[model samples]
Target: MASEKMEGPSAPAVRRDPYEVLSVSRDSSDQEIKSAYRKLALKYHPDKNVSNPEASELFKEVAYSYSILSDPDKRRHYDTAGFEALEHGAMDMEIDLSNLGTVNTMFAALFSKLGVPIKTTVSATILEEALNGTVTVRPLPLGASFSGKVDKQSAHFFGVTINEQQAQSGIVIRVSSSAQSKFKLLYFEQEANGGYGLALQEDSEKTGKATSAGMYFLHFQVYRMDSAVNALAMAKDPDAAFFKRLEGLQPCEVSELKSGTHIFAVYGDNFFKPASYTIEAMCAKSYEDTTQKLMEIEAQILTKRNDLRQFETEYRKALTQFQEVTNRYSVEKQAVDELLNQREQIHSSFTTVRTVAGHIGASNGGGGSKAHLDDSRTESQSDDGSSDGKDKSNKKRWFNLNLNRSDKKL
Candidate 1:
């Protein structure tokens, strides 16, 4: 009943085991865990205990615990890795409309407007009508089909009765809708009191194919739900009931069904438009008789496979080209790197030569002028004195040799 954001614990609250939080064992069945959560949630619900300051927190903890146990994937992860493996954002808000009072519903609606992802159960009105035998239910026999229009926010119910033999062989109920039709497939089981109770609900999936006339279609496959839990008790806590029912749900196998009438309801989910659809009930044997249609579906599969092969061929060609270009780029890059190294060496040699020349010019312009004058006088003297000329020639030869060595080092 609390209208808070219903998020996981943000602060470091006590990290209790989910099983302990729900007061159930780790090996408990899904139904047992669900029942425990419902009991705790109803007890700690904010609407009933307004004076208790801790009731809201207890309600959130109860919801979070159930969220982990309700999902098989999450439950397995928790069992293996504990709460650290479960992400806080993965916890979704689940509201049970049948269990909530008027005030709680008002608050839930207000919070829903604030963008919380609150998953509500089937409308209490609808469930009540179904229980009272007021909702219209049309009979759909095996190998037969019915077409109808269901208005927005409404549903069309059909009852399919199967005997022990048919139940053993199995059944497959398929529903197809016109282009862009949005609806849900709801399955129900008849109770001992001759009233139908909700069992499972599934959204329509696009068929991914179009007719020759270019009309798209949506398809539905009946999924079986566990009908062991009490429907009357579930109506009191629908959210928990919904999650429990969802666990282990698989495509309908009539062998697992009882020999009685089962209900299939097509509920329109479009915002403003009605849905036009055809519902068909077929035994598994009858379904196998549609050999031509099956072949057509197989042909579509083959075409898709061929298209995949073509894509793979093109992918390989593209990959080969990519590798060739990459190799070319690597070769070109190496050539460019070698040229850059040569250019750098040349630039370095030029810089060293310029530095040496600048030093020589500075020395010559300063006190080196007197030194040059002395060298000239000495050379004149050497010309007059042959012995001195020989000495000066030897010194000039040594200086030339040292300059050549320096240039070689550069």
Candidate 2:
């Protein structure tokens, strides 16, 4: 009998390249994988394309790719060994994907470009099947209290997601700064379930308390939306301005520290605090680097302020010159009017002389002393009857016989 073909168990068949399965780079971000799954699902979902059963197969692949890549443990294992290293059935095996809704894939653009072949719903179904977790609904009564210290045990990142059934569209959530700082926080909201989710490892992460006045944490918020979608970016301070962009959805992504009593007013509006709880922390840098960065920023600000002051001085000087020019313009206008009036008077007096000079036939009529009409001007020409008006022409004459005169003033 022919040797039995090397048959395998009903485990997931390993695809050529896990990265190619997800249609992403080897170093793609978690958000990128999630986004890719969503797009692939829409394309290859059986429900989306009834004529294409192949889409479902592609969908299953994308789901599997995202599932294995997203989990840190599984990704590490896959990296070290070939596909066989993971528990055999682990590839196609069913895993819970729902409860991790708390985790958001902020990068929407990267996935659409991954060039995967699948439908979105299929991918979602695959995802929904792969990473499902238990979700607990912790409801608090109106005016209830829930507080405590949440000193994070590690340097990793963590975040909180809140969903209110009543508000099913958009939910704005808050994350406090530190122990003594409360009112300042970073906020996030996603999903039609009215759930809010914040980043655990974001540098802008805050877990402080509210004590006194304006001096507090600053939240760095990035306002963006899928450039193609209407998803709105959270305003930097939520009060700043509305900006939107991104190719997928949730375009804006930045962590800003909250300030003032606003955080308390929103968080404790219905619930109070207790003694201890599951508050999370983020990957903060070593204090030295952070401090040095801040100092650099402060120095840049001072330098910029000095530059502005110099520019202001220059602006003021220009303004003064502008005022002076305006004054000169007014004076010129008055002078022009006076000159016009003087011109009229001179024209009146010289009009007759002008008329009389022409009557002299242009030469003084051979008498060498002709009497022109009207202001009947007298002219002493050369004895030869040539014109003799040279001394009166201002154009060629440079010497002044009388030098001590102070006659011309402008």
Q: Give the count of colliding residue pairs in each prediction.
A: 0, 53
**How do the residues 1-410 of candidate 1 rate in per-residue lDDT, one tens digit apiece?**
11223225442245567787888888999757765765576567665667897886777678777768877768999899777677554354544444567788667666544533345544445655675678998999988989888885578999889898887656666677756475667776565577776655655544564101111111223333332222322444564453333333333322255568888888765444687778888776555445346447645654654565576578668879999999999999999999999999888876677788887997878877778888988888878765485787888899999999999999
Highest lDDT scorer: 1
TM-scores of the candidates are: 0.51, 0.26
Question: Per-prediction RMSD in angstroms?
Answer: 14.6, 25.1
Look at candidate 1 and tell me the lDDT of residue 330.
100
Candidate 1 minimal-lDDT segment of 10 residues: 210-219
Whole-model lDDT, model 1: 0.63
